[model samples]
Target chain A: GAGVSQTPSNKVTEKGKYVELRCDPISGHTALYWYRQSLGQGPEFLIYFQGTGAADDSGLPNDRFFAVRPEGSVSTLKIQRTERGDSAVYLCASSLELAGGGNTQYFGPGTRLTVL
Target chain B: AQSVSQHNHHVILSEAASLELGCNYSYGGTVNLFWYVQYPGQHLQLLLKYFSGDPLVKGIKGFEAEFIKSKFSFNLRKPSVQWSDTAEYFCAVSGYSGAGSYQLTFGKGTKLSVIP
Candidate 1:
C-alpha cells in the first residue's frame, strides 16, 4: 500500500513570499498532522486535523502559518510572508482514528522549504 | 503542555557495538511514547511505540525500548548495531489535549553514526 507522500519535495522562495506545501495521507487514515523540523531541532507540531476539521493549531508559531485538510485526506500547509526562519523540513503524518485506542502514525518524506 | 528530552545530541560507535539512546518526557497525564528513525535523505520512520501493557516493547530492525513510568523515560536499545543503523533518532510523546488527542511533543533528536 502507498504510504504518506508529500509534493514539491524541495521548494525555494524569496523572503516575504507565500508558499504552499501539500501532503497526501495514507488511505483510510482519519487523523492528519503537520510538523516542522528546523536545523538541529526535532520536528515541532504545527497543526492537527481529525476528519475535515482542524482539531488544534496551537503549535503554529504565528499568524503567518496556516494549514487546512479538506475531505480529511489531503492537507496543505500555507506560509505567508515567508522568512528565513521558516526554512525547514515540513513533515506530514497520518494514523487511524484515536477514539478506540492508540495507533501508530505513518510519516511522509517531508517537504524541504528554503526561504532566501 | 508536554516536552521530550534526548540526552545525547550525537553518538558514534563501531559496527556490532551495543547502542543505547536515552529519552525522557514530561507530561502530567496519560501518555504515549514513540521512537522514530530517519536515514540519510530519508523521511522519519517509526521504530517503536509504547502505549500500555508491558513496559518492554520490541520493534523492527532489532530495536527495542523500555518505558519506565516512574522515571518518565523511554530508552531505545540494540545489543548489536550495524553500520546501516546510522541515522537520526527522535523521541516523541503524546498526551491528552482538549485541542486533540494525539498532538506530539518531540525531542531535539539524537544522531547516531555507526562505523563500518
Candidate 2:
C-alpha cells in the first residue's frame, strides 16, 4: 500500500466484548507501531514490532490488550474483554527503517473504538 | 518512564501572526525528537524532526523547530500563521539505545486555531 491503512474506521462494542483492529502497512517497511489516543490527548504508545517479532510490548496497559504482526506486513490489535474506559482511537504507524534509529513514522487514519 | 510535555493546551491566533508551541522531554540519554500535526478529520502527519543535525530543523508548510538539548526542548515555530495552519500539534521523542528498544513518547497535543 502507498500508505498505512486501518480497517473499520469506527467501531462500537459493548463492554466485555472482544474486538480486533487491523493495519496494513506500506510495502517493504520494517517497523510497525500501535498507539491509543483518548479525547483531547496525544497518541499513547501501545506496542512496536520489528519484522515478525514484537520488539516492545511494554506500552500495553494490561493483559487485555495484545497485538501481533505475524507476517511483518499486516498487524492486528486485539482487546479482550473491552472496557468503557478503552473507548478511544487506535492508531497504526510504520517506518521504513527498523527500531533504534531515527526514522519517519507514517500514520494511518486510525480506528475509533467506542466501548459502550 | 520517558515523557514529553507540551505547555499550551490550546492557542488561538489571527492570520499572519507569529506562532510558537513549546515542547519539552525528559530522558537521561541521547534522544530523537519530532513534531507532528493533525488537521481536522485527518491523520497525523510529520512536521519536522531533530535527530542529530542542526538545532533548527525546517519542515513542511513553512514550519520549523529548534532542539535545545540543555533544556530538553523541541519547540515548533512558524514565522507567520495561516488559516490552513489550524491544527493540533504534538511533540514526540524516542530513546536511541539499541535495536528493538525504540518507542515514541508523546505529549498532549496543542490545539492551534488560526483565524483568517
True contacts kept of each: 0.79, 0.77
Q: Give the chain B TM-score achieved by candidate 1.
A: 0.98
Q: Specify the highest-lDDT model's number.
A: 1
**Candidate 2, which CAPRI tier?**
medium
Clashes of 1: 0
Residue-wise C-alpha lDDT for candidate 1, range A2-87, written one tens digit per residue = 99999999999999999999999999999998999999999998888999998888889999999988787899999999999999
Q: Each model's C-alpha lDDT? A: 0.93, 0.91
TM-score per candidate: 0.97, 0.96
Residue A65 error, candidate 1, Å: 1.3
Worst 10 residues of 2 chain A by lDDT: A95-104
Q: Candidate 2, residues B1-116: lDDT per residue as tens digits?
A: 68999999999999999999999999988889999999999999999998887999999999999999899899999999999999999999988535475677899999999998
